[model samples]
Target: MRPFSLRVFVPSGDPTGVLIATRDDGIGKATIFSRSLLGEVKGRKEWNLPGIYLLVGPSKLYIGEGDPVGKRLEDHAAKKAFWERALYFTAETRLNKAHIQHLESKLVKLAQEAGVVPLDNGNTPQAPALGEEEYAFVENVLADLLLMLPLLGYPQFEASEVAAASSDEEVDAPHAAATGKRRAAYSAMPRGLLFHSTSKDARATIETVDGGVLLKAGSIVASEPAPSFDVWMPKYAQMRRQLIESGVIDAQDGRLVVKQDQFFSSASGAATVVRGVSSNADGWIGADGQNLGDLLRQWKQKNFC
Candidate 1:
């Protein structure tokens, strides 16, 4: 990606209430404020303008728009307890109600389709009609927002790693099959390594990806976490419970089978969740049957040099 300039300001020396602005002329600005800072955020001049905003917490998300944004945020702060932080988007020139409404509807649809975060929005808002220029402007704003949100520690707007991987597979499959050379090039490329659990009873394969590790679809997880599971791997244990509750894993033939492709942020995370024990990065192996550490070193040497 090409380099772009971003200016960030902390009004009260608190990192939680940050103002982010891009140097790009048409891209606009975003204010990231913690829910605790609602009173301070409300005092900002931006709140009086028409804008779209995102309310995000650890696991839940809500998207909204307001003609005068401060009132909406004030209402949410009073009634909504799940959100810890909010991100508000506004233009250089104040947006009209119709423009903000259209942007809100599109962002809500995007969040719902991504399915990475649980949406707290009870109902989907209808998008207002827009002229060609207005629609194009909103689209550009959306693209910029997606890039900026991740930088501000919110990745819920981005597509899930599994979805991105699946898209890559679809695009590469036919070309690799037709050219044969494509397959050779891929085999030679320093891509994410794959591995299998060393546990005798666990029939699972895992692969590391750009942002996370994948517990491939159809892999097996323990029906219940190990007795020492929480003591050794508290996060994975919690994730396992969440997976079960989310219906991503189901008991089938006396074992837990993954219902779909699942992504974890690290190899050890995926391994612990699948094997129910603490795992080391060295435990995994790559396509050439080398240990993960060695494979990674080799990849870095070849690519970075």
Candidate 2:
């Protein structure tokens, strides 16, 4: 990966209200400000240029573009109640109304596919026409914006696990080596963990991976959460519900089965959602035939000692 530099300024002593600029020439700049700081930043010169912007809230996202970007933000502040912060992207010279419209169209599509946050935009604009050079330039700008957005606490544009897994790029040698070790260890193990739903005929295989756990496709989950499901954190419950609602998992043969591979932040999180009960990460067995806790201890000794 190519290294890039970012310069961020906090104007109001509040880190949430920021101005982000890149070292790369021709790439655009971004300003991320809270709705409360609109009065302080609305008159800035960048807002007068044609740009694409995002309105982000706790659970929802909206993407748009306009010339004289200040006016568009003002209108959204008056009408859109969910968003608490806005991020605007504008170029010094290359960007124009057509370029911004194209960016808006592409961003909306990406956010929807990411499914990291729900979109509030009712309509998606069609991408505008541009020459090959201009299109490539805009793509570079968008790439920078995507990298910066997540660091700024706006993750709506982050790629989904499936998308990341299906990327065409070859894995780095070190990562490929580690993955090979994991697969070999798993193959030699007697068995993986099996989590069973308390309220239904559902079960799933649990496997450890780098940084987290994987719930393999075709693994089963309860069709509905059990009455005692409150044993798990609300966020885990919500995640399970979202998976069902999104049709990522569906009921068949009296149980819900995952349609695609899924990742969780921890073994316990994956287990809790699969079993609809409280779970302990240490209880999960690893490929070495040791529990997760013991495996982690061995790994730490080898890598960190």
Candidate 3:
């Protein structure tokens, strides 16, 4: 068996929900799940996580004004109701007025900065009636948790080794077919990567194949290819142009345009859009040392020029 390791980093002091795992020998890869930034999990810590959070920020606040924003807003309200009790039970009761009030102040600051009007003073802040301020603060806390996850681990999380599956079956399947004794090597596959354009004009699509990796438009940027996963690169002018024209992608949002692939919808069956830098360590093409724009320019010179 290949050497395997499983380690996770949850920032020392931050409360963001982040899951970082590294697998196999040192050669194995590392993956990070930004619970807050990815919006994959509601709370970064089982207890200290906030209830309602707003995605509004200078970043491409994946949640927008029209249908997208409206839908997410509705879900946030429903989540407050459905998970209210459970979330409270899991909260870090250790939080005192000082802590809670500090968070509250931060929420107010963020809201005002973002131009969000505060809810009426009469509204309750917790479950059954969580105030807008409380909700927005939770989101801020979530983002903080995500930022801290990478710092949590000493070296990073690790993953266990997984054996590669064998294709040969029954020994003589192919030979049997030739001799009329058995069937031929049959490997049904799923097609994937149908629509990989960063351009919003290009509708993200995926054809079923034996092995499928759906890369859709507006998908979140990540090192690995998976559901709600994507990489944002405004450097791709073609992609940026399409997204800007499509009215779905926003350039000033500090996020690259990436649509979702229907094949890999959220557990809620909704399309997910995350904003962040690549967390795949070495998996990212030009992450640490090189600038993406420089690389793109080189690519254009070689291929287009």
Q: Looking at model 2, report the run of 10 residues with the lowest lDDT sum.
A: 163-172
User: Model 2, 179-232: lDDT tens per residue?
Assistant: 554344334434445432233455676655544557888888866454324221
Per-residue error (Å), model 2, residue 124? 1.9
Model 2 C-alpha lDDT versus the unseen true structure? 0.67
* Highest TM-score against the true fold, candidate: 2
Task: State every prediction's TM-score relative to the real structure.
Answer: 0.52, 0.53, 0.19
Q: What is the C-alpha lDDT of each candidate?
A: 0.68, 0.67, 0.29
Off by over 4 Å in 2: 13-18, 23-26, 162-305
Better of 1 and 2 by TM-score: 2
Please name the candidate that would achieve the greatest lDDT relative to the true structure: 1
Ranking by TM-score: 2, 1, 3
Off by over 4 Å in 1: 92-94, 161-305
Q: List model 3 lDDT by residue over 1-305, tens digit each.
A: 22334455454334444443333222112223332333433333432322222332222121111121223334544543311211111123433333344333433333333333332223223222334454444434433432332344311111132112112222112353332311111112223313221222222322222322233445433221211111112122223233445644543345444543333211101112222211111111222454222332343355444
Q: Write the per-residue lDDT of candidate 1 for residues 1-305, one digit (tens) a residue.
A: 34666677778776655665554543567888777777777777887878889998888999999878888988999899889889888874747888888778877777776677989999989878665566556656666676677887778765543311111121223453433432333345444566776564566777666444678888888664544344334456667877987889888888888899897645556766777655554556665677654554465456545
